[model samples]
Target: MVLQRMGSVKVASATLVAALAVVFALTLMKGTYSFGGFWSTEAHRNRSIDLQLFDAWSNPTLWYAPWLDAVGNVALFIPFGFLLVTIVAGRWRIPIVFSTLLGFLVSVGIEVAQYVYAIGYTDVDDVVCNTVGAFLGACFARILGYRGRGFVVTLFLVGALCVLAEMVLSVVF
Candidate 1:
């Protein structure tokens, strides 16, 4: 029994790390990186931020862009929350609190990086969507109880799909 529990923790931790890697890769390295260019005057001119919540949805010319961004941002963090709950499974309150805080912090970190690196827009909507997604995932995990390896495997599958989607989008656009 102890061995099984240990194994579950290991699997959850590994899945969490992989999920986070995917998040960073998709967030930080989405666009081609050019450090010198980022520091150049021309590159810095394009940097943008939207502090107002849900501002992305108001784009008149690009109605679908905001929806896609919101869904993708939320989906990206779901697995993180699920795996986090699994890692600390059996505890009711700790898992929820841990996942929520960690997920929010992670989202904020990514947003800050996006601004500093100028790789993408720094939108408050993304943070809100991500935190909500994480919280939802944690709730699901708590409700479903610890399914152990199954959840980890599912997370991997989801991560793969996300990566594939990203690749296709990059190639197409």
Candidate 2:
């Protein structure tokens, strides 16, 4: 039993590192990360920030694009949450809380890097969605019985249904 747990931990750690590397490559090197022309005007031109919370929903013209982006952000951090919780804790309570907190901190770090390096839009919306994603991922890990809930699953189901309803409404009305 001890050896099995140790092996699992090692696997989780490796997978977590790989997942984070992919995340960094996707986010940090998104728009621009030129080494030679780091301070060029062109790099600064692409840099933008959106501080208004859920501002995307305000524009009807944006329609499904913003919603899709929100889902994508959540999906992106799900693996991080899952792996981190698996590696860090054997119980559900601490893993859920810490995974969410770490997710928020990591998302904030990514946003800060985006702002400084001018990689992409530093939007608070991403932070919010990413945090939620991490929380959900931790909950999902608990559900798989690998660590040892219906609550989070039900909540996510409801939320997903609501999103679907809104999408249909937007198209019909």
Error of 1 at 12 (Å): 1.4
Worst 10 residues of 2 by lDDT: 32-41
lDDT of 1 by residue, 103-163 (tens): 9999999889889878668889989999988998888777776544464445464665676
- Model 1 residue pairs with clashes: none
Off by over 4 Å in 2: 1-7, 32-45, 60-62, 91-93, 147-173
Please provide, for model 2 over 1-173, each residue's C-alpha lDDT reduced to its tens digit, 9 standing for 90 to 100: 44234326566666566567656755775443332222333544467999999888888454786877789899978877877777776654588899999999999999999888777689999999999989988877766744232232233334444544443454355
State candidate 2's TM-score.
Answer: 0.71
List the global CA lDDT of all models.
Answer: 0.73, 0.69
Query: Against the true structure, candidate 2 has what lDDT?
Result: 0.69
Q: How far in Å is the alpha carbon of 104 misplaced in model 1?
A: 0.5
